[model samples]
Target: MEKLINEIDSIVMETQQITKQFQKGDEVEVTSHKLGFVGSYYEATIVSIEDANHYRVKYKTLLTDDQSAPLEELVPIGHVRPVSSHQLGTTSENRFRQYDKVDVFSSDGWWFGFISGIIEENYYVHFPTTGQEVAYPSHALRFHQEWSNDDWEA
Candidate 1:
């Protein structure tokens, strides 16, 4: 596992180039950078472009302290991604491979990661956002895809 984690780290470093831009009203998924909320992503809409590196977004699921309104804040551009359109169904057979982009079911939500290693029936997933690795069964993993123009594409 240690060796696999090291390889995953290297793979993560090689894939750090993200150049995504969004216009106001575009729906997206934003990874939480907060202390306790790390590793989870919530649905949000880009309310406005704050600047070159940030977006003022209104979360669909996250709420403010008083619970009266949706939480709105400036999220770093790197932490936001377009909404995923294709979600694979869970199955018993191992259908994923190392370095494959996938979403792992954990913490009551699907957290994005890559398949770092496969051991028998379990898969080691590496999450770039939190720099964490976890082993999950095949049923807990799914292919990650992006939504584009009313269609799902890889």
Candidate 2:
């Protein structure tokens, strides 16, 4: 059992490292740093690559002040991640493991983070935007996914 778990972990790590660079028209999720939206990732399409470390994305949900068009902005590449292929499901504490990307319910919205450690019935999640580690009960955590092509894939 232990060996099998190790093998699975290896596969997961390799898959994560295999993510390639983003290109135009690629659907993705971008972390928002705006007030009241920090730590939240929003659906977006890569409209253009500004450079090696920046992308001009048009948000699917966010809109302009006049609400006439979708909001577009330049986002740092590090703040973007490929849309997750896992869907949110019933909370199962045992299903979580170290290094797994997850979202935690907080401040009225789901905040993107990763499982840094597990302690008994609690998970220590690290939020990259805040550089903070927080403990959350399993019930408040879920696998991160993005809504794409009229369905949830991550």
Candidate 3:
């Protein structure tokens, strides 16, 4: 697993050197599973490229009937792959070793649950890595990392 992840990291770095076309006002198509934008792709902004190979996109979902209301608010979709430049984002932070617990967050800011057993078809979870078990579609999850028990204010 370590070797595979290292290989993936190298591929990411190589693609970083290539120039890609991304704009500020462009109607970006981000992949997720929400509503009109769920699974359907989202109209977002190409905020700015944080680095040579990375892009920063902001996604927002409006209420179905209420124009002024937002079914979901804006946060971060996250870093994407360089080869598939148009993808939204999903993060596999530092990574969780066996027995580590995690809290899964949906794009609209909802916590699905804590880490559970792994299955083939994403039963309780969706995309299951070695330690990270996926519960919802990539878009459904907006935030997930090791569940921190430390006090941030400390």
Candidate 4:
């Protein structure tokens, strides 16, 4: 819905603030109780920042220890908050950033997609879950403080 996208846009703006409070390689812990399905707890590395509202969080599955099995999480700036100031014996200053790739899902909560490219006013996505190439007009997608990064691998 248009309203949803607008709301998400507003929240995404905070990524800049969160980034300013943190930085790459900073050990971070995320509380998941209030978010999407992955919402329970998340511990990851601030691998990269794409912008002020998005982040490339590199972390492993909590239940798995396979180093090769790594997931780069795209968390909104507003969704990630400081739970611990000290991560791995260091303090982090939010850097307000994002990643080129962000996980996206459909409005029905039944789709998972990855942003493959970013343009001036839109992005192209290859949704593995549905095997569909979808284009988003930036204004069509909605984001919540809690977001779902699940999609079928296309």
Question: Per-prediction RMSD in angstroms?
Answer: 5.4, 8.3, 13.3, 16.5
lDDT of 3 by residue, 1-154 (tens): 5654453333222212222355555444344334322222343566675665455665555354556643433323332211122222344653323222223344442332333443442324422222334544444323222111221110
The candidate that achieves the highest lDDT relative to the unseen native structure: 1
Q: Model 2 residue 23 lDDT?
A: 90
lDDT of each: 0.72, 0.70, 0.36, 0.45
Which one wins on TM-score?
1
Candidate 3 regions off by >4 Å? 8-15, 28-43, 47-58, 61-105, 108-120, 123-131, 136-154
> Per-residue lDDT for 84-116 in model 1, tens only?
664554445637888887877676456768888
Q: In candidate 4, what are the lDDT values of residues 33-57, reduced to their tens digit?
A: 2325332235577788779777677
Give residue 13's error in model 3 in angstroms: 7.8
Off by over 4 Å in 2: 1-19, 91-110, 113-141, 144-154
Better lDDT candidate (1, 3): 1
Best-to-worst lDDT order: 1, 2, 4, 3
* Whole-model alpha-carbon lDDT for candidate 2: 0.70
Superposition error at 58 for model 4 (Å):
0.9
TM-score of 2: 0.52
- Stretches off by above 4 angstroms in model 1 are 7-16, 91-109, 112-141, 144-154
